[model samples]
Target: MSKPQVLMIGGGMIAADQILPSLYQLQRRGVLGGIGVCAQRGATVKALADVEMIRRAFPGHSFRPYPDPATAGDAPHPLLYKELIAALPPRQIVIAAIPDQLHHDVIMTALRNNQHVLAVKPLVLTRAHAREIEQEARARGLVVGVEYHKRFDDRSLLARRRYREGWFGEFKLGTASLMEKWYYRHSNFQNWCTSENSDAFSYIGCHYVDLVHFITGLLPASVSVYGIEDRYPNGNKGYLWTDARVIWNNGACLNVQNSLSFPDGAPGTNAQGLSMYCSGGDRGAWLEHSDQYRGLRYCYTQQPDAPGSTMFAEPSTDYFQYVDTGGPGLEVVGYGFRSIDHIIAAILRVESAREDQRSTILDEIDAAGVIATPSNSSYNEMVMEAGRLSILNGGREAVINAHEITLR
Candidate 1:
């Protein structure tokens, strides 16, 4: 079978850091055809194309930048992705790595174009939108996978298996945190992650929320989020700090704290981890993951040029890292790359199956639960919707009953 062409709908930090390189590696291995990336402005795409790390790592590999990077002016072309999606051949792949609010439209566009989609976490802001996408994709026999990279982490997979086997018992209570560096206040996040659009919990904290479900199979039943509003360097206000309480259906509680307030000089890129306490009748159990620090510490002679980088670093080997394997460039390792590769491989599996059996293959993919799909992961959207409503309403409790979300 011929390889399916790939189109990336966003060229921001994720594209440069994880998605594009993963795609380049697949291209290197002959798993993909031509790859193209389209962004709001030519400058964003150009910046991704000019990333020195990517150039050195991938060697001769590059993506076709949309809007003609040379002639397209500084003005933003928000609808340009529509045109590019329309032109792609049927049953190709489209990666939606845009903002939280824009995921619905871009994903819908891809599905309408007869394309398989791999979206970043928190697929959409609302459960209704997630259901809509799920229905549309299922009707057309297309696969829609959410890129919750944490699920691919070995720690998470092991915990999931053990927990299911009654090793960790029933999760009774937990705490999680994922605090990004303070420098995020100055990045493009200042423009989009505003008070009206998203908050710390809805943005980064959802990882733990999803992780909890991915590990325990328990659905979040209620959410309450208290957000602290702060001004970015660009003077835009956002919910930069947040504290949330999530109650599972079985009466378990998970407290999650998130913020863009980690000190710039901190040893790790970010501080993140999960600790869960479970019950097993006569005994108790526990699970903990210090994800930010992976036991490797380095006191470099010189600090890196990136903002907020530190001379003393505790690099995480489980997320995304480039290591020399005596190759032309570098080999990308970690759960980040593995997550993207897994979704693409699932797409390839469906495509390789007989046309009449494609639906069955998609069903099996969803049932296997290895890769997150709208049909199986819509609870994430429900939690996001609940979090947003609670944060906006002064931390009122938002109850999720059946498929609806309401504040109390």
Candidate 2:
């Protein structure tokens, strides 16, 4: 069997930061075949290709840009990804790294084309779409993995194991926050993450929601999100700040706050962490993770040219980074790369098996719950849907049952 060719559907910040570099490393390691990237505009794909960090980290590695890198302009070809997905060979990989609202269509396109998928977090905005994608992929015996990279973090894995072993008792109350830097206002987020489409909670906050479930086998029963609307630099209004309360099935409550309003000059890239307090008989246990400050502080002579970067920074070594290890090009390391590698490996595992055994492999991947498949992680879609509903309706309570999400 030939190595699977990989095509990324969106060339945005995530594509530059994690996905593309990870793919380059996989290509370098002979894990994957040719790579391609399709974006709405040629400039976006060109910019991703020209990223200095990626270029320095992976020399002699590049991707086939969809809009034709030779013709450089801001012309938008919104439907180009459809053509590219159709052109790919069956049983290859198609990565959906686009906006939150666009995940379903792109993922369905891949599945319909008989291509496996690795979608960004919060697979879709609703459980219905998730079920649709799940049924489609399962029927075709293809894998669809959601990129909840935080689950790949060793801390999360350890906490999950320890908690399940009765070390931390049962999760009772928790709080999690992930705030992006203020500079995000000037990016394409201003256009897509508007009042009508999505909010900060639905975008970044879903990580913690999913993480809580990943750590403890609890399902959210109700959610209420109060969003504060603010305008971007482009004069478009969005729910820039959000505070949410999620009630689990065991009557546990989790408070999640998310925003793109963190000061750019702050020492860390963003403010994020999770704190869970539990109880058992007369004993109480606590699990706390200061995700933003990873115990490493650097004072540089000059501030990095990267947007929202500070001269004195608390950099996280766990998320994603490039390091030299006696090689012609730098190597990509961290949980981000691990998450992508895991999903691609799962796809390869399924593809390598005989046709009759492929279904069993797919079933095993979903049952293991190590990777976030549509079948295993559709609760995230429920939360996203409830969040959007609550945010739009003045933060009313949105209840999540087995079948549907309704407001109270």
Candidate 3:
């Protein structure tokens, strides 16, 4: 059988760089059949583009443009939504990459009409919506999933292996950090470099949150946060922060701090890294600025040297040399160090659903959007709680319930 037909809801930054190319590859391999894409007319460069790009990539695939509600340009072309939705073949799986504010409407329409759905991260904007979507999909026996791809990374996979194998003793504390400056100055890049939005905590930091779960296999029961507001604000979509923190269920916690507001906006100099603490295993890695540490990047780990030693040293001769520099001055972004690779992998499926194991990670993705709380409704409440705490409560409190958490 050919790849199941796919319908992409948003055609912005993620679509252009990641999902589109990936799906086009799937199509070429005979794993995907017809493909359709809809991007509202007035979105920023990240999420908006002309059809020529898609046409050139998937020449034979069906591609179209619809008003994207998430973008400012969609206002004048509201009718395109239904037109795009209605034109799709019945039962085709829909991949919606829209944000929280708009997910409910778009996804519900598809579910009510009997289509499966694949959603991007932060599944729903609120707890209520989470419950609602979960119930709907299960009731309809349809697939619905959210993307959390950190679990797919090499480092993450090793962490999980050590945890499961008991290479680490009791697993006392785990800390994860996402720090860096990925901001764009108005004068440097063109009208815009890429991506219309880059909220440190919600958007970028979410990856670390997922990583916490991946390494420890422990889901956060709740989180209390502290965040910052950005100056440039990523093409004006708003909310780029300097730092954030999250405490999980096992009493082990995580601290996530990120800033697009770096004094220097280069990847190497802007620095971001993670450190984890466990009983038998303790590990950490960091980036040295291009000037001081040029090509001196490394990832070193250490175990207890003796039974009661309070200190640690390099366990063996194994360490990775970090190579995060390639540009002069401060514009090394032109190099191939874009985190966009991770984003692209999330949109792609390496194998057909049939070839994938049932009840595996990929299958879990389909179940991710389903909610255990809010009963038969969506998790709009939980999202409201997160949003409220983020904007109003000074990040001291976040609305999250472990029992109510829909997916692991």
Identify the superior model by lDDT, candidate 1 or candidate 3: 1
Per-residue lDDT tens digits for candidate 2, residues 1-408, read: 588999999999999999999999999999999999999988888999999999999889999998996885777999999999999889999999999889999999999999999999879999999999999999998999999999999999999999889899889999999999999999999989999999999999999999999999899999999999999998999999999999999999999999998999999989999999999878999999999999999999997999999999998889999999988789999999999999999999999889999899998998888899999998899999999999999999999987788999
TM-scores for candidates 1 onward, in order: 0.99, 0.99, 0.65
> lDDT of all the models against the reference?
0.94, 0.94, 0.49
Mind giving the per-residue lDDT tens digits that candidate 3 earns over 1-408?
Answer: 235677777666556645565565555556567767664454532343444545454445544345433445435553455566666665566777655456677888877876667666656556667778877865665556554433443455676676667766444454555544443333222122222323456555665666555555565555554555434533443455535556556676666665455444222334445666665536432211111122434332553332222222212111111222431111112111122233223224422334334225333444342211123112323433453455445655563664453221
TM-score of 2: 0.99
Which residue pairs collide in model 1, if any?
Answer: none
Model 3: residue 375 alpha-carbon error in angstroms: 12
Q: What tens digits encode model 1's per-residue C-alpha lDDT throughout 308-374?
A: 8899999889999888998889989999999999999999998888889989998899888879999
